[model samples]
Target: MMTPDEMMTLVTENALEYGPKLIAAIAIWIIGSWVIKLLVSGLNKVMDKGKVDPSLKPFLCSISGIVLKVMLGITVLGMLSIEMTSFVALLAAAGLAVGMALSGTLQNFAGGVMILLFKPFKVGDFIDAQGYMGTIKEIQIFNTILKTADNKTIIIPNGGLSTGSMVNFSTESTRRVDWTIGVAYGDDLDKARAVIKQLCDADERIFKDPAVVIVVSALADSSVNFAVRAWVKAPDYWGVFFDMNENVYKTFSKEGLNIPFPQMDVHLHK
Candidate 1:
């Protein structure tokens, strides 16, 4: 056993030997963190200048900086005589547990990154996916948000979206409008076709290149069905659909065309 004076002297010598190292370790960590932030910001600017995908830049920079900072932390801890192997073991175990617990969430996050990079749809595009049709409002880390035509907000997981079929209605600049009308068999087919063609010609929103197709589609027991297919700018699709529907009925009525009502005839014979 050492005397009191000897123990005190030993303590002072240990402090003198280790205190600077401890201060250096802490200073390195704090300064290294600030430096990492600066580097990441500069890297983001470089990526932007290179015209990298905007959505991917942030994730790449953040992940790269975090990995570098963690390595720096380990290096500093080792310099301070800390047990680096034990810290690494703890990190590995925690990572394994987190991976197991958050497998689905990680999959969604990965899918979200893919969606952002590939840009299948953008904000304001009307898309159908996972049995929902709506305009894309936001793209988040794990999910995408949409606003439906009926004014409902919908949130869809990115994992489901990635694995399903996506129909983007707003991808094309032009959209086709097709409407079917049924007229009584007694009404003149020529007259019905002429009315539809005239209606198409009168609409300013309708495109004339493809030309309107007003043709007899079917002959049923009760009535004759005709189909009017027209092309219009995508922005005018809904307006044209509504206008053509109303115009067809009004024009047919004005021209004395007979629109048959649904009816059934039942007879009993003895």
Candidate 2:
């Protein structure tokens, strides 16, 4: 409604008041971005030095970078005199909704972090958990991949894996193998025991320090059971077990020992 002079004066006043603020805001943004990059780089080096898991390193770096950039954006927005309280509240509300929606996923992610930190098992380790047994193929953020003995692939959720009981077969360097050998009740127990001990002593894979145990464990309905226990390297357990079984059968047959089978003597009276 006024003259042109009024418009020019108002414009000049606004420029005088806000021009420096705009320039300062731009400078802060530039400096903040540079600082964020430097800080993130330093953090990555620290994580490397700490030996963080390889799978988690990239995710951690990405999350940290995003958080720093978001903070910088909020700071720049604040310098521009944008109302941030409402924006912050809106962000909180949205975060709450998303968090609720992805609660299970977040739990799995947290569990994965714990697993990477604690290292219950590693890739290629054989593990049994949650009614599944297999060798671990991968440990991911949400799931663990397993390849079973029968060549089946299984995906197990990390949430349950972290909380449930896990048996890591590869954790120890050596393992004990136990077997029960049943022979006919009339078989010579001392001869059977001697032959079993001889076979165990000849096996190079079996450890002698623990000393193999061959004892008459029980007398069942049809046969006498001998408990054979031996220690072997972790990797040699399965091979030793199968070989011992084969050796027992062959030696027992050659020695004229009878392996008892269930038999019913039924007599019909007419």
lDDT by residue (1-270, candidate 2, tens digit) is: 978999999999999988888999999999998998898889889989988898888888889989988889899889888889999899999999999999999888888988887889999999999999999999999999999999999999899999999999999999999999999988888999989999999999999999999888999999999998999999999999999999989999999888888999999999
lDDT of 2: 0.93
User: What is the TM-score of each predicted model, taking all chains together?
Assistant: 0.76, 0.85
Q: Candidate 1: where is the Cα deviation over 4 Å?
A: 1-43, 49-56, 71-90
Per-residue C-alpha lDDT of model 1 across residues 190-219, encoded as one tens digit per residue: 988888889899998998889998889999
Relative to the true structure, candidate 2 reaches a TM of 0.85
Which residue pairs of candidate 2 clash? none
Scored by TM-score, the top model is 2
If candidate 2 were superposed on the true structure by all CA atoms, what would the RMSD be? 2.6
Off by over 4 Å in 2: 265-270
Task: For model 1, state the Cα shift of residue 130 in Å.
Answer: 1.7
Each model's lDDT comes to 0.90, 0.93
Instruction: In model 2, state the lDDT of residue 158.
Output: 92
